[model samples]
Target: MPAESDLCSLLALGPRPGRDAREGACNHGQVTADEVFFREWQARAAGETRSLARARALAEVLGVLPAGVPVLVVVGSKGKGTAATYASACLAAAGLRVGTVTSPGLRGNRDRIRVNGQAVSEAEFASLAERLERAIGSLPPRTGGYLAPTGLFTLSGVVQARERGADALVLEAGMGGLGDEVSLFRPEVVAITPIFSEHVGVLGDTPAAIATEKAGVVDALTRHVVSAPQTPAVAEALERTVEARTRKKGLVEYVEIADVPQEHLPPGLVQRAAQVGCSAALRLLEGEGLALPDAERLEAVLSTVVLPGRLSWHRVPGADTEVLADCAINGTGVAMALVTARERWANIDHVVLCLPDHKDLDGAIAALGALPVTFVRLPYERLRFTRPLPSSWEVIEAAELTPDRLAGLGRHVVALGTVYFIGQILDLVDADTTRLFTAP
Candidate 1:
């Protein structure tokens, strides 16, 4: 690592005051209460990595559940949010009241927790947060002190579901499944999305090792598991972990994306992953005697499935430029985005990235292959990281990404990095943004 002055000189930008620089939110003006709540966790995680001990303590404190309420633990490296959303939405469309807990909000913290595809009202969120605070206050402090914002946010979502009389609760593990709070969840169904090379430092260094951590989400009581397609190494590791239970109970299933035709869904890697997760989830639900919606209803609901910040496309106003924004922070994500962009543009001329300081920056840049890149900074605080700026790419402030500036990059531009930055750009590009992306 470089000294503060050296780092700034190298990046052509100064790092903000660590904690006081800004809260975990976009420049969309005022800070929200939910953002404030997440900041509390940020403050507690200061200069420390999360631990299994801390996660367990936090889960014990917030583990209250309504009798017979089923939880579906969505576990994986990437696409967990989209997968959970699809499963929840599909199940809900089938007449079951569904509540989902997602991470790294698209709009704000309000998008973190939802029931029946809608964020809970601000008042309801406030009330649930207040109750959670009180409950958390009653627990004994950790020896070193820690906070699990995902756990708190997740539990609050479940509490909201209980209050609203929900039939199912979908929980996503923010990180590795082993130590993450969702591991404590008594899940009736555990759904594993695609495994990607991420969090290698914290989870493990290899694909098989990471798969083991992911397989930890399934326990003895877990009646069923629905997994998206995986590479051979990932499959071996996952099978090794689940072998004992499988031999005794015969309860492991896989859903291959190759089997699912993508002609009806939105065209993208994210949508394909969603289809895989939804297909597996549907199979599991059917086996469990849950009556899923008819083919027509499922088609209608899936036709409206919106995957924001994942190779989402848009045509910029007042120009013929085609813009695609993605939350591809890691090398693999960036590589996939580049491939898809190449597929669309034939020869992608300009690549805009806003990766945080902690990602595989060299790998991400290398994944750009021959395409030129322009580096920009976004709000990187508690959630994800950004890499130190490379001396080669042009560095610009987050506010510098105006419409006219982007329009000049090329006839086709692929913008990627963090969801925070992509969402911010979407906000700047179009004002009538109801969802994460503007209507094309």
Candidate 2:
């Protein structure tokens, strides 16, 4: 068997549609080179002298690139990817060529890179990865040392996206700003979606600390800083950070998202956040003399925008049950998800949950605990951490899992928590047709 490094090389060798004699049979016409490369790269980085520092330094180096095109850097505790997607979609709707780069894809590796609201093809991703590897290999080691291949790869994607003629690029920052790869590129506009408590160990133990970490993106901005309405503690932290930095460098302009008002918000908060992001984006474009449709048209276009996996609903195949896979793993997200679920599925009887190891387990339990529903815990095979899950909930094994089994328990099965669990469960439910709808 080839070594992991060899596997990375083979996968990076461009997306071949058919089975290769050298590599095994192709799954879905292409292998995921980025996944293979990142996994190996992450493993190597983990073994290095200073993994976190190395990751951050590498991300910083990768973040800096030749500038010309407009860039939108989205940073926050949650809703970063969704906000980025909405921005990309809005730009595309306005007839502008836009590219978006996000992490932890839902379906396939190609889902991480999208142009004009469509995932780049496997062949394109493979070619880009190969080119990126070569570029990183050629760069000289800095006196202060250089970043790793993962950060370099991320930077390469941004550069590639720009090279593809993207009028604007929507870049989502990694977990935090200080060391996140996205912070390297000095964005023309920096947008913070919303602050929440997650990644406590790395960012800090409190919401204020987390906010300060996220506020690092604001420092890298050359033009404008757009922030979502944050909690008092978070807002104070952000204000302190921004004020201290702006005093040193008077080029940054901070724009509070609240200044835009809830009335200007596009019907739903999710949609409103998206519109606000696009509004900030449009304002950036307008400064560059880019023509955009009238306000009414832009608002209309935003009204049609849709984001999947956040309160995403679909009908179960065999059962007359409806399933909701909301990507709300933290406290605030869980609260929002519960509210949305209650409004949409007033008659829901059962709620299925599969939370990530990183989620606020206590908060999640409390949120669900209040619901007048029986809870069935889904399998946690794919999750990294599993200890924090509630003890009283029923655990369903993968083999024994079926829509009929779920239907036998209650009328509606609303699956909330991690997106991965929802994705996995949905796939299984789709494949089994025996558990068809009997009587509504």
Candidate 3:
């Protein structure tokens, strides 16, 4: 294996993609080479239909399908990562080695791909990175754009999982399911979290339209699907899409808020993710004629799993403050985070927002409602404010938010923004994101 810096240089050898690509380099605080690769690949891919085609071609080159294990594809606007992680946990607890691939890694890029709760080692990642580059280079040119970074990472995870002998694979879709790279495989099970309006212009303008795109994950091979509670329009879209895809021969299960007993839940969006994830695992086991594991074991696994960046609390060294970071980019998500914060802590002294221009600022402000709190805005390249700054709010650069500054601000602070921004916060506080699930 090459030295860490050598691996970084080798990966960075290719031409930077997109216009003014250099400008897209890491603008946040110190980041690892893997993080740099993630941002660079994100800049390269457009996540369009053409990009999907390129990803499919790359898959063909790698020959990654007929995945010799039961595959689960988790898709939705939010909570997909949580749901996927839980499902992996349930499967692992039931005596199966599970691999999962999620987007926008919380701490490090390697965190996006894991098998049975442990991240792939740097040596393994570097080897696969070399193979992936060779395969992409060998592909014939086409009209499609660059393969999406999310798709590339998903493919890398698949390769890593297969090499590591994973018995099952769980995939969390990117922004949209149909166009996502993970849709390349025909999964045995598909899990749907709550569908809402997000990625408005790219996926579709409404919840139903976006749901339609997500529903595309239910290919002919899918025998079972479990969904969390969804709005009428979104549910209808899922129903129509599933019916057409399955030809009325498949089973669809819905998990309502009431369906999940409150006593077993861990609060906030985790409750919904737990409900949907367990349901999906149960359905998958039933389809395979495998006996369910001990209920206590499953519950224990669910209770212990740590989902970072979704109301996850971390303490900064040398600081009296504790940061509660959430990757809530929309109004509904922001509102849920606020509720969770209020319930977890008596008072939220400050609210820090690092939102993109396209985020629902007005709706987020409306949700904040009458709370006597200070608002801090931390701006990044992809997560900048759209309008003029508020006179009362304090604006800080990502580099300036150190332990000392954060401590002086307040004892309890809520950080809200895209996953990337939250990653910055996690990096700043040096949060432990190495583990997502644990084996029984």
Candidate 4:
């Protein structure tokens, strides 16, 4: 990887993608190279309140929002990421090319943007970044400036959609939709999953406040808003937002989770994703007059949709035990992971948890407290805000989680936390899925 100084210079001078990493250059905005630029951007975006002005300003600078491209915007505290991913799969399965952009990537920045189901390759990412260089660099640096990287990413997704002649675009909100980058797209439909009390400091202290921010995705331009089951407070908040923002008495469709067909669904969060995703997808497809998939094929697609870090498990080659992981960001999300872990594993010896310094640590610890297991704190090996390990839990370094040590535990080892941390653990373990498979 090129040094930080070199990357800073490149970021300042405008990204020069398509260069080979072998030549000590950021291989045309590849994952590793992109991180350098994203890091610099994060320094400018972190802790900043979501701003509509910022989103609009960046949109004006990019000026590449493709016309007539169907947009599906998902906003919520949980399940939105999975909903976006699953919806994209459903659309593609129905034969429409889909361009997708999501956040808090499970592995790397590349995972945040995709064509169909594949991550954007180094060349493609670089070429797009290079194409929009001037626009991205020209944005003024405000105190809590626009989340330049995210806007750039959304614009790039739109470009990819146009380039691939994608019939649709799937976007996952970076935060609450009141001023989230995704909201600027003027979505045709907004799908919100369950809402929880997150970003309380930024969004608000009450569930209604949080829900309003989420519901704000349904701007006057939105024709429809679809969502899974929601709390009473959240429901009311969303209803109010729709009533206030509807362009021509737009409809708000609240699809209950139980309504989704799940006879052949898998035993994870993907089922919830399918329920909401398929429901929202069907609404969008039917509204657009696009052909929907057959029942049998739809079932097959939903059944096989594997979203990592959502009650996901994978084994390292030759390792005796399987590693279960999830990128759940809040206390409720953490609790869901634990419940799923209990159902999948007979004897879990350790539930390794990694919570960022900014998250609800108390809520997470409370949720995990009942489990008959040990809590080990592991470092999040990426550059982000992280609180110190509490005195209660045992501390373990990421580098120390050797495959042999994990195998020695003689019980299930489930890892949970940020995407980068999970990716770092897998990297350290050098997990090679092809070598062998160990049933979890």
Per-model TM against the reference: 0.79, 0.75, 0.85, 0.79
lDDT of 4 by residue, 138-253 (tens): 76765654344555566677777778787888888766675666777878888888787755655777878988877877766677788776788888888888878875443777
**Which residue pairs come into collision in candidate 2?**
58-147, 318-436, 318-437
Candidate with the larger TM-score of 1 and 4:
4
Cα deviation at 247, candidate 3, in Å, is: 0.8
Better of 2 and 3 by lDDT: 3
- lDDT, candidate 2, 1-440, per-residue tens: 01221222222333222112223444643444564345434344322321334444433444435435788878787777666766665566566777777654444346567776666777787877666555445555433323433344456567667767877788877566655666666677777777776666557779899888777765534466667777889878877776675554433334444322244343334644564476557666666687765556555555544455667666666667776657667666667776776787666677776564556767777778745433334333323444645555776543355556656656566666654455444443442211111110
Name model 4 segments beyond 4 Å from true.
Answer: 1-61, 138-144, 247-250, 257-260, 264-266, 328-345, 356-393, 402-405, 426-440
Instruction: Return model 1's CA RMSD, one decimal.
Output: 6.2
- Which ten-residue region of model 2 has the weakest summed lDDT? 431-440
- Residue pairs in collision within model 1: 356-385, 356-386, 356-387, 357-386, 357-387, 358-386
Cα deviation at 122, candidate 3, in Å, is: 2.0
Per-residue lDDT of 1-440 in model 3, one digit per residue for the tens? 00111121222222222111324543333134344334334444343233667777778787787677889999997788888887888888788888889876665567878998777766766777777777877877645365556777789899888888888899988667777777888888999988876666667879999899888888878998889878888888898999898787435678874333467555676678777886787778778887777878776766778877888998877788888889887777788998888887899888877665677777777777655334444432333455664556666655566556666768888888766667766766777788877787
Question: Of the candidates shown, which would achieve the greatest lDDT relative to the real structure?
Answer: 3
Ranking the candidates on lDDT from highest down gives 3, 1, 4, 2
Clashes of each: 6, 3, 0, 2
Please identify model 2 stretches exceeding 4 Å from their true place. Answer: 1-29, 39-42, 45-64, 136-153, 219-221, 244-272, 330-332, 356-358, 370-392, 397-411, 425-440
The local lDDT score (0 to 100) that residue 214 gets in candidate 2 is 74
State the TM-score for model 4.
Answer: 0.79
In terms of lDDT, model 4 sits at 0.63
Residue 100's lDDT within candidate 4 is 83
